[model samples]
Structures are given as C-alpha cells and as structure tokens.
Target chain A: MKSQDQVLLSVRNLVKNFELRANSGLRKTKRIVQAVSDVSFDVHVGQTLGLVGESGSGKTTVGRSVLQLIQPTSGEVIFEGQDLTKMSFEQLREVRRQMQIVFQDPFASLDPKMTVGSSIAEPLVVQGVQGNHHDKVAELLDLVGLASDHAKRFPHEFSGGQRQRVGIARALALDPKLIVLDEPVSALDVSIQAGVVNLFSDLQKRLGMSYIFIAHDLSVVRHIADQVAVMYLGKIVEIGDKDAVYRRPSHPYTKALLSAVPLPDPKVERSRSRIMLEGDVPSPVNPPTGCRFRTRCWKATDLCAAEEPQLEIRSSGQQSACHHPE
Target chain B: MSESVLQIRDLRVTFNTQLGELRAVRGVDVDVAPGEILGVVGESGSGKSVSFLAAMGLLPKSATISGSVKLDGVELIGASRKAVRSVRGKSLAMVFQDPLSALNPVHRVGDQIVEMIQSHQDMNTHDAEKKAVELLEIVGIPQPDERARQYPHEFSGGMRQRVVIAMAIANNPKVLIADEPTTALDVTVQAQILEVIQRIQQTFGTAVVLITHDLGVIARVADSVNVMYAGRNVESGSVQSIFDHPSHPYTRGLLSSLPHEGIERLQPIAGFPPNMLAPPPGCGFAPRCQLAIEACSAELPSLVPFGDLLSSCIRADDLRSGIRS
Candidate 1:
C-alpha cells in the first residue's frame, strides 16, 4: 500500500463538456455533450492509476483534462501540492516540464521528417536544458530498451513498438514526475505489446515515477495498475485496488464488462455464464439523467432511473457507483 | 465428423506488389462442418483473413489464388465471376468487422437487404421488405420495422453489426464467414453479438468461419480452432484439445503471451512475425519459437499427426507429452 504523504496527483470533481452544433431541417441548434462528469481520484507517487473504459466512455477525456490538454468545465487538479486548474499560462509552463504524456499511435505523435533523436531532444531544448542534448537523447533511447544508434533514424524507419519506445523516451526526457500514457499498448500487436509493457514497468522502477495509464483493455490495465478506476460515460463506476476490483466487481456494468472479456482458457470460457447486455451505449448529448448505464442494465429499477448513485465503498470493499449493486 | 459445408485445401494466395510478390497465404487448409464454428486466430499478416477472402472471391484481380475451395462440392477457386456471384448470397455470406464500411450509407438498411433478396431470387419489393424486417428482428435489433428505415449512420456500432448480420443471413447462407465481427464494438456489446451469432448458428445450422486475433472470442464460440503463424496453419484441433494440450511451440507461445487476470508477467514471443516476401525456407515460426531445434530451420515442417491434433513442428511429438526441452 502507498503512504498517504506522497500523493502525486489528486483529481477532484473533474468535468469536461463539449458543445456542438446540429443541423435539423435547415435549423442549426447547439448541443452540449458531457464527456466527463464529476470524476475524482488520487494517484500515489511511484505508482500507477489506471483509467479504463470503452469508446465514448470519456476515459481519454479524463486523461486529457488532467494534463490540461483541454480545459475542464469544472474541476481541481492538484499535482504535487499545486492546483494546476488555478495556475496561469506563465505558471503552467514551468509546471508542464514535470508533467508529460505518451500517446497511443507512435506514427502520428512523432514528426516524420525529424530524426528520432531530435524528437526526444526537442522537449529538453524547450525547457532550456543546459547539458548536451545528443547525450541525453542516447541515454533516453538506451533507457527505453532501444539501441543508442537508433537516434539518427526517422520515425518511419522504426517499427510500431520501437516508435512507441521513442515516444516513451521523449516523455521521460524532462525527468517528469508523472506521465499520462493514453492507450499506449492498445494499438500494438499481442507479441509486441508485452515488450513495451515490460519496458514501462522497468522505466518506472528505475525512475520512481508515477503514471496515469489510460486504456480500454482491462487485462493490460490489470498488469500495470496498482489502483484501478472504471469509467462509464464520464463517471467512475468503480474504483478499487487491482485485486479487489478484478476479483469481485460489484456493479452490474463492471461485472458485465469483466464477464464479456473472453479468457484464452477454453475450459473456463466455455463454462462461464456470460452476461449479455442489450443495446448500445446511449448518446452523450442527452445522457440518461440518473445512471448512464441503467438503460442497458438488467437490474434497472425506478430508483436507478430517478436518483443518481454515489461512488461509495460497499460490502465488497470496492467503491461502486450503483444503488442496486450485487 | 458431420458433412463439411465448406472445405479448403492447399490454399495459397500471393499478391504482386511494388516490393515483389507477397505470399499472403501459404498452404492453408480448413474444414467447416455444418452447424459448427471454426475459429481461425492469428496476429496481423498471418493470412487468416486473406485465405477466407480468397475463398470468397473477394480478392483483387492482381492477386493469384491457387487452392481448392469447395462449398458442398462446388469449386470456388476457378469458378467464373457469374458462377461465384450466384452462390455468394444464397449459399455463402460474410460479415465484416466495421459495418459502417460494409453498409451503404446512402441506402436504408431494409432496402439493402431487400436488394440482396431481389438480386438472388424472385420476390416483389413489398414481400422483400417484409422479409428484411423479419431478418432484423431475428438479429435482436429493437424496433425492427422502424430501424430498417434508417440509414447506416443512425444505428450504433453494435446495432450496425446486427444489421450486417441481418444482411448476411438474409438468404440463409450455408457458410457464414465473420472476420473480426465483434472487434469494433464494446466488450458488453461484443458479448451480445457473440450470442446473436451462436443463436444464428444453432437455428439455421449454418457453418461459421470466425476469424479474429482475440483467443477469448475463439474459445467462447469455436468448436474447432486453427492457430496460424506466418501464413501457415501451425496447429489445428478441437477447442478442448487445443486449449488443454497445445502441441505446437508457436501455439504455446501465443497462449502464454496472452494477458489473463491470473497471469503475473506475460511471456512475450521474442521476435516479430516473418516477412511474407522472403520467408525462411524452413518453418517460418522457428526464429521466434522457444522450443525450436536445429532441424526446425533446416526444413519446413509439414502438418503431421500429433496426438489428437495436427501440428507443423518436428517437436510436436515431444511436446504432446509432459516433456520440455
């Protein structure tokens, strides 16, 4: 368990809303899409907090808002004892050096024309780092399990996994205290995914850095995350340690999602009683007033439709946001 | 085994590209019996999708396919376009991963199914439209009649896939090829889609050729499974036999590499998949295979009998037992 004193990042009541215009019979109308709503969690130093959900569940939005890549509608992001939400642009630039990000697609993140070494060194140059940038680039490449000679090559010259290593190397160039990895391995093949995941673990150990790992794959999240948060339509449906959540998920949505994941073990896969939820996720523009997941939940009742539930610790020892939890 | 609704033998597909000939499929063989699900699983460029696409005559003109694809003794490899078209809708159908691409955005969902019906057999527009609504209802789509009038963009991903399934089973095809049908949907929605597929298989007694990279999907539905590696069928057996006793080293490596809740650290296959343009003369998986011996790279191993399964590895016999190198 992590000590309470070393809280690296604390996100409180984070909300993100996107406004869009719609054309209805030649009349234009503006609509509000609530991507994330009132989300809160804490990340301990030298640890990982995994945020997992399917597409449109706003897991990526939460990650982006925490990094202030996009301004949140209302929230408090307390990183390293400083409120990032309240910081001005001038103050934020100084704090940005310690907070970095690694994207899922390596091809799009890196510039095609620039050499991999320059891509990693650009951050150091922007921060006005004094030491030799080339040496730092080589050191970073080696740290990410890439050869030092790979610095001269372009992003296109490297494979998907190698390019992701370069992305990780770039994120670590400023000696960041925390890095937000958004679906870093979801785009990778199963064989290559493990190597990148192992490199992430190795880098964390060597640097003693905190990570906010965002991904849709629960199995991959289970491997790296010490604490896990399950998001559904911008809210944390469940939050607990890896063992408690994965072993005994209380909410219907969590149980359904976990059961839906097919285990490679044929014996277990064949015998398991799968929870087949009906219909697709509702539109975020006009989300269900109460529980966002209640539309498809089998345990839906009037209370679920009338009153929203709070994410509280239940008898199962995990915080699940559902009134009728199993 | 029951009568095989579809059979493939010595299936090889090659594409002439700027980078020379890329052998997409290398001597693949598959058999799908009536009312049975055969899951073909592999990573990207493993030839799982290309083999089935070639069988369906969906490949481009530049690609050359030399294989024996028989649907109830009807040869499809050398068949003319007219001949293949006749059998495609009535007896052979396919469901793709992204229904958004497969479905025509301009046409209503019901009209598309009606078009399929009118093209295949003699049916008026009214009767065809009614049958289309029935098909939608069968796939578990809510408000079948109302939904059929909407375009592809109106439906959610899971619903669009159901519409695709509806279009596939419109004429009760004998063999349904689903290539990653549930990959684009959510996990909970994927379970629903899988259930719909199973129900269709049982009700119509149609053979299903399910191709995907996820082993979990295969384990849930496939009665028989084929493990492909570097454009070849590395292992083939019943799902039970393959899961309980995987003989091929490649199969073992893939299973071990898969992330499971109980696993602590994943055992990643060291090397990448072999390049199809200039594949190794011997076993393609030998470079990444952990149990590979000296003889493995000397000559390409054939699919030989190994216990109840067939594995293309020289050490298949040794691996079938409790032995480990």
Candidate 2:
C-alpha cells in the first residue's frame, strides 16, 4: 500500500465473516461465510480509491466495514490517525461526522416521507451545530447542482439522478473528509451516470474530499479513480495506480475481468476477442484452499493449488497476488 | 442479410394509469433475422422492454396496444388468443431477467422443462423428460440428470438462468427475446450466460433480441442495434455504423456519456429522461440535447436514412462525423 503523510483512512488486515443456518428438513447446519479476508488499503486527502469486483468479491463488504456500517470480525480501521475499532460509541459517533456514505439505489436510499430539505438537514441537526437550517440546506442543494427549490420536494418527485444529487448533498452537509460511494451511479442511466460521476469529480476538487468508490463498471472506475484495487472472492487480487493497472495488468483475474467488459464502439469490439473465464465464482463459505481463482485460471499449475500467493510489489508498482502474473 | 424472421411495424402501446395516460411505447419498430442478434439499447423508461412485450402479446389489460407483429410472414398482433398462445412458446419464446421468479419454485427443474416441451409437442412424460435432460446438456449444465432433480432454490443464479434458457430453447423456436437476462447475475456469470446464448443461436439458428441497458453487453452479442429514447427509436443501424458514426443527437449523447478506457472525463448529457405521461410534442430528447435547434422543439424529427443507418435527427447531415471524446 502507498504510504502518505496525509493519510485520511487506513485499513489493515480487515476481515468480516457472516453466520448462517441452512435447514435440511430434519436438522440445521451452521456455516460461516468469509465475506472479506485480510483486505487492506490506504486513502489520502484529495484522492479516490476505486474498488472493482463482481458479486461475492467482498468489495461492498470492505466499503461497509471501513464506514463502520457493519462491524468487522477482525481488523483495524484508522481514521485521521485514530483507530475506529478501539473507539467507544460516543467517540465513534464524534468521528462519524467526518465520514459519510452514498448508497447505490437512489430510489430506496431516500426516505419517501421526508422532504429533501429535512433529509439534508438531519445531519446538521444531529451534529448540534447551530445555524440557519434552511440556509444551510439551500446552500447544500446548490452545491450538488440541484435547485434550492428542490429542497421542498420529496424523493419520489425527483428523477434517479436528482435523487442521487440529494444523497450527495446530504453526505456533503456534514463536511465529511471521506465518502464511501457504493455503486453511486449504477442505478442511473448511462447519460445520467456521467453527470453524477462528473459531480463527484468536481466535489473532490472543490471540497478536497477523499473517496472510496466501489463499482463493478471498470470503464467508469477508470475516470474517477486514482488508485485501483481488484478484489476476487474476499481478497485483493491486484492493486495499483489506475493507468498502470489498466494498461499493463499483471494479474490473470484482472485481465479476464477487463476483457469481459464490452466497449460501446462496434469497431473496437469486433477487433477484440474476449478472454472468458470458466465456471461461476466459488462459494465464499467453502472457497478453494490455495488460490481462490485457480478453478477458473487458464494458467493454473499444480503449485498454484498447493501454495497461496502473497501480495508482492511487481515491476510496474502493482501489488499483485498471483503466482503466475501476466 | 437473410430475411427477417420476426418483424415489428409501427408498434404503439399506451397504459391507462391513474397519473394520466402513459404512452410507454410510441410507434416503435424492430426486426430480428434468422441466426442474428438484435440489440435494443435504452434507459429505464426508453420503452425497449414495452415494445417487445407488445410484440409478444403479453401486456396487461390496462395497456392498449396496436401494431403489426409478423413472425415469418404470419400475423401475431391481432391474432386470436388461442392462435397467439399456440405460436408463443412453439414458434417464439422469451427469456426474462429473473429466472427465479419466472420458473416454478416447487417443481423440479427437469419437470418444468418437460412441461415446456410437452405443451408444444404433445409428448408423453418419458420422452419430454428425455428431451428436458438433453436441453439441459445443451445449455452447458454439467450432470444434467442429477441437476434436473434439484429445485430452483438449490441452483446458483447463473445455473438457474441456464435452466431458464434451456426451457426457452426447448421447442427450438425461431426467435428468442431475452430481456436483460444477465443484469441480475455477476459479471463472470454474465459472461457464461452470454456464452450459452451465443451457443444457442449457433446451434439452433434462433434469432435473438437482446434487450439490455449495458452497451458492453450489446456490443458483445448484437449484430445490429436500435437506440431508443423516450419510448421511440431514435436510431437504427448495424453495430458498426451505430458505433463508428452515430448520426442522432441522442445516440451520440449515449456513446459520449459511456465511460471508456481512454476517457479522461465524462461528457454526460444534461437533464433527465422525459416523463412518458406527457411526452414532449416535439423531439422527445430536445430538452436535454445539446444539438437541439429551434426546429427540434417545433416538430418531431422523422427518420432519415444515411449510409447504412437511419437517424431521427434533423441535424443528422450537419453532424455527420459523429461525437467522440
């Protein structure tokens, strides 16, 4: 991980395991789903870290754990040089003022009963910072490119993109240092996704905000992210700078995932042949012993299933966890 | 190209809702040729799904539909209930997005496929069961016999979709309309499902209509594409023409908005999709279009044919080189 003087968020050896019971007619069996395992990353001021993965990759779990939305099974999340795992409820709430999150589905994230103004104002009131609430709400609305009059309307009255802007406004209301965006624009249309992505960039520039953007769209991640981490089956398979990783990807999983993405251009697509991976993602509860991706890896050898590879820095500054790096 | 196996002409659908009449699909048309994949690209309210639902004669009573839907020169839109039912799963089949909901939960996976085969071919249980296992094997499902005995809840998302696809192809239909079949699955699973779809088209020579919002998915499988905006087809062309030189302002906006590897910044189209209840009298995309002129707001732009594409933009000639970042 890249060390920086101005570390906004640092995660070390993070892990999250969920417990579930499956009924088999007469009996129930307990199982543990290792959602996230030993995931670590660093976020600095005015930087964006894009976490890219498919379902069951634990990308969303990492985002949620960093935000303390879900308690990790074992890990250390340090925010502004203070460890969040050791903080008390009161202290954690105090620290939460500097952290906020924007969820994926704008339709469900916003409360239908509350006006947009009240939703944005809830954070301000919670922090007990005395101010003209109406003025603050209006300012926040304008900041996210929404009209000040939009504050009076409910979530259903607005479009998906507008609702997302309201969500951004609420996150910005707290003057947070870091924002965890979990598929923020995935719900929006292609044209609308661009607008929301641009707003994020502008906000990062104007407010000097650090972001942890989690999305499955590799192309969209290229535009917003400075650092990129590719996760597969509860572990980080590759992490490096955005340009380096996209240009000269070292990990086999990263290469396959990128090739699977279809470019909108027909000429480019016709010229390219996809490197398709075989089989579905193995269950997290019973993941493959050594390399999680060995089952689908074309270059897998006998040694791959015998020894788990550690994340090591390669020549291109990419920290890849693959015995057979491309 | 070969003759169109499924042709839709001047399709219009309006829903009688409480919030006024919502014109979901407005005179939309599409074509599917034998063994060719046609992609209908659009946003949530773009009527890509509605148009196909109308073509299949599957809309609810609240929706008023009028159009000419022909399957191999046979009419389907105004056909009798029995006629439509006989043709639906036999000559034409559809693959929905959520296979879990579409498939019966209590029935065995093989039994369901057997039912699909038996209903169309009038076969006995033993033969239909044999055909069901064969369909499963063709869809790349390993251990077809053992997996067929499992319930819907027992299979993974990808496997369930494979089963659904097996049922869709049971009768070897000429046309298969798949509406966002891969949207609910993971990317890896999406690739596997798409592979199955492509293989199905290759083996059965079935025409596929792949309706999805993902430009990536469309690019992967679609031979030709129809770009829909606000309940209308703004552009129709070969995949090459649509990507190489998009003539419609809406099509250009869509391509530009899509983030790619070389993209440094996104030039997102401003504003939102139109409200279908009271669609704009002029060009539906005029309010959000950067290339909108006075004429764009005064009247609807008729489809104008270019090299190999048809674009519904008044400024198509002026903006010929296409918009690319």
Candidate 3:
C-alpha cells in the first residue's frame, strides 16, 4: 500500500469467545460468551473511528481485542502490514510500542504511589529512550495543556480533568501512531469532559495520530469521530461517515441509540418523539439465533430471526446490517 | 399559586477543615412548589449538593449551617439532632449518586429499604418488607420479590440505583433530593432512570431537587433550573425561560457549550470554574464571563428579576440586547 493510502490498522472477522461457567457446578457443561463475533473495521491514518454501544454490547471487548490485550479466538489484525494475531510475544511487544491505550478511569489507570511526571515518563524508560526524561515529561505535560510544575504532583492531588490530562500525556509518551481511547472522558464532569475532548482533538491535529475512540455517548462521538460504528451484541449493526450515520441511521438499533440521547434543550426534548426500545438487552452467551437485536427490534420479522444479515453498503459508503433498512 | 412544599432562605453551609472553615454554600434561596422538579446545575464544588445536604440536615457534625429550611412550613435547619432525625426520612429524603456505595453490602436490598421505612414510621418488619417490595415495583424493577432478596452486588448498576430510589421514597417524603442520580449509568439506562423518577414524582406529587452536571438530564426532568457557580446562584428561572433566553453570561455559556443532539461540533467554554475556597471578590463567574466588566469585579450582584427569569449578573439588561461578546 502507498504511504498515504495505507491502512494503519485493519481488523477482519475478529472473533473473541470467553469460556464462562454455567450456573450449575457441572464442569462438563461449559458455555461460551461470544463477546466479539465477526467484527471487522479499518482505522486509516490520521482518522478516528468511534465504536458505540450500550452496556453489555461488547464495545470495550472489541477495543481490547484490537490491541491484543485479550487473545482473540480467531481473526486477523493487520497493523502496518503485519498480522498482530499471528505475531509472537516479542513481536507483539514491539508492536505495542507503536500503539497505546488511554483507559476510562484516570484514577484507576495510574499508580497511586507514583508522581504524575514519573508515570508519564515510565513508557519512555521502558522503551529505553535515552535522554533527560524530565525534559520529555515537561514537554508531554505542556502538550496536554498542563503546567510544567504539575510534574511533581501525584495523581490524587490533581482534579479529575487534570488527571485525565496526565493520562493523555502518558498515552503520548511512546509516540504511538494509534491510541485506543476507551471512554476516556466518561468518568469526568461535563465541563471537564469538554476540556479533555478538545485536547484530544488538538493533539490529533498536531501529531496526526489515529484514534479508535470508544464511547456510548453519541454526542461526544459526533464531535470527535470521522467514522462511526454502532455495535449490538458483539456485531457491527451500522458503520458509516459521522454525518451519514448520525443524520440517517440505517439500522433500527442505531436509530434507537440516537433517539435515546437527551437533547440539552427542554423544548426540543418535549417535542421530539423517541424510539424507546422495550425490554433489556439479551445475554451475549446465547444471543438470538440470527440477528442479535431482533428480540427487541421494532422492524424485526421471522426472516430476521432465521437468517443472519451481513453488513452491506447501501449508499455512499454507509454500511448497515438490517433486513429493513431506513 | 400552589403552596411551596419546600422553602430555603439564605442557606449558608460551612465545613470546618484543617485549613480553615470552608464555606461551601453562601446565601442560597430556593423554593419548590408541589410536583415540581427543580434542577440545580453546576460543576463540582459549586455548592449544589451542599445546599441540599444542609436543607435535609444530612451534613456531618463539622458542618455549620445557618439558614431556614422549611418543609411544609416546618423548620429543619438548626433543629435538634432528634428533631432532624425525626423528619429526615419521613418528610425529606435524599438519594446519592453511587448506589453501590450507598446501599449496605452485607444486608439484603429489601432489608435495607425496610429499615429505612421502619426507622421513620411505626411499621412492623413484615409490613415494612411488604412496602419495600411495593417501592421496588414502583421504581420499575422487574421480579421485585426475587430481586429484593438479593444483595447490592447481585443487581446491575441501573437496578441498584432503582433500589436506592426505592429506599428514598419508602416513607413517601414530601420532598425528594436526587444528587446526580444518573451520573453512574449509561445513557440509555440514565434515560430510563430519569423517566422512572419523573413518573414517581408525578404519582407522589413530591417536590424534587435534581442536582447534576449534565444539562441534558436536567432538561428531561426539570420544571425550573438553577445555575450555580462558586457557592452562589448565578441564574434561576423556569426551564423554558432558561433554555430560551438565559440572562446570565455563565448560564448562556453553559447552555451553548453543551453538545446537543443533531449538533456535530461542541463549543467548549474557556477557563475553569472558580475555586470555591477562595472565590473571586465580586461576581464568581467574572473571570470566565466573556461580557465581564470592571464593575462586575467591584461588587457582588444579587439575584434580580429579568424577563420571566432571575439572574445575578449586572449586565442582565444587556444580555437580551445581544451585546455579549
């Protein structure tokens, strides 16, 4: 692939299964939970692809599987012309230098005993980047809009927003090409969430880093994502450009997810008719026979229960897995 | 006009800390009519939570509260320990943000809720357990009988919050205070929780004080909105008035900065919230306000009535004239 046209990371037919124990004490009756089944997507250079789903929809599992943090049962993760799944431990460790992850909880992710500066410089030390780590630490802090003086402070001393900045600085320490932000700002206050999000956008612009931003909030995804993927029970129900997917959602699950987001304006919230999906999300271990969302989908039919629909492009690069597409 | 179910006047709450006395709430005035959901919107340390904690007499011994908190014309603030305890769960109850931490880990969910009802009212254990199941059903928890027997860890995050709500409303308090109730749940589940709260508020006709940082959650449940900053009320009005024509610069900035549905890009407000320990001398939001002036730094502004709204900014007159920069 040409340099500009090269796909930074491509996942094909990724399948991740967990051997969860059944309710009974029978070890013979082992059950498997298909956390991610046949999920495929590509992350281009300097682009962001958002993975959105409600709780228990396996969005986080997909993100972790891409990083090879969890070994996938079957699939290919082609990153920079190498299949990460087929790589050995040492090869995967080398690949990890080019990819980093910013976890959801800033407090939990950072070591409580370490200072913020030491935490950010830890990756450089591990990679044996020979230099004055203090200078690089200050530079990383400045990049994420933190003061140089904040280097000495521990994570507990800083506010929630500042700690997230520290997390971002740590993510950038390795000079990675791709950063998987798994709900980076979900644990923050709204005002603080905006600051961190803006910092992410600016850093992406400055460093040209690709991001796989995973979040359940559609509004936050809209501001950051170039491409959007809606997942339902370990499957990509819809994937398209930000505007096309949000403005004209093809799948019923995508539409319901969009309609469920509450608008800031009271008048608009009162006037808008919401597609409130009834019933809870089914278990992933034994999901519906065909379409996972067919149980609660309004447009589901007998055909939906019998035949699994493949994700296909309908118009203008927008793909959706639905028997009845809007 | 309907009688106010709860009236709070000049509420001042301060916590005695090692550093000094930290004034968390300063001269807050709030009133809630029957069946109205009053939203208190602000970032952390804005005194939105502290104000209600003082009203409910839920603060610790270190907290020094001076103000009148009246629920159904009965004073709560500065009441004796026994008197406050007597009215706490019966007349006014609060549901905290994290239900997992709020509920007892060792006790069954039903027992904890039953304890809440029995402590305030003269009910037997059997009757209280019956009432607890009724509350679980009221909050829309399926299989209430079986779910009630489970521990806090057995239920999901959303279900745990429902159990917390069940405990709060077990005594049928006249006023309910939900402090960031849906902050811990997912968006879809947050909507469901908010809808359940709204439905319960309507059914019980309880005055609710919904405290949260999310403007979207506020919009869905609030009949009135209060914009707080640095331990002070910057703006207060009917929800429609606040959304349509916000008189304060801080309120306008907050409303505009929110990422609404169908909007692609968000306009983030510059600067951070003022430090409550050492807030600015005059208007708390002057440092972040785009339309701030030298006069705004000279004297603190009091709540003044605008067109169908109340704002503390001196430039409220100019706010509607489109002079905000």
Question: Under the 3 Å rule for N, CA and C atoms, how many clashes does model 2 have?
Answer: 0
Q: What is the C-alpha RMSD of each candidate to the true structure, in Å?
A: 1.6, 1.9, 2.9
Point out the worst 10-residue segment of candidate 2 chain A by lDDT.
A1-10
lDDT of 1 by residue, A171-282 (tens): 9999999999999997888888988898888888889999999998888899999999998888899998888898999889989989888888888887888888778788
Better of 1 and 3 by TM-score: 1
lDDT of 1 by residue, B177-254 (tens): 999999888888898999999999999998899999998888899999999988899999999999888988888877
Q: Residue by residue across B1-325, what tens digits does model 3's lDDT show?
A: 6888999899998888887878888889998999899999998889999999888877899998898999999898767889989888887989999999999999999999989987888999998888899999999998999988999998888889999999999989889999999887877678788888999889999888999988887787899999998888989999998888889988887777766555545566677777666778899889987888999999878899887989999988888789446
Tens-digit lDDT track for model 2 on A173-218?
9899999999999888899999999999999988998999999988
Which docking class does model 3 fall in? acceptable
Give the Cα error of residue A98 in candidate 2, in Å. 0.6
Give each prediction's DockQ, rounded to 2 decimals.
0.75, 0.76, 0.48
List each model's interface RMSD: 1.1, 1.2, 2.2
Write candidate 2's Cα lDDT for B130-174 as tens digits.
Answer: 999999999999999999999999898999999999999999999
Count of backbone collisions within predicted model 1: 0
Model 2 misplaced stretches (Cα beyond 4 Å)? A1-5, A23-28, B321-325
Model 3 chain B worst lDDT window (10 residues): B259-268
Assign candidate 1 its CAPRI class: medium
- Candidate achieving higher DockQ, 1 or 3: 1
Please provide, for model 3 over A1-326, each residue's C-alpha lDDT reduced to its tens digit, 9 standing for 90 to 100: 75435589999999999997666664557889999999999998988999999888788998899899999999999999999999999998888999999999988999989999999999998888898999999999999999999999889888777888899999999899999999998887676687788888899889998999999888889888989999999999999898899988889988888888888889888889888776567788789988889998889999999999999897757999999888
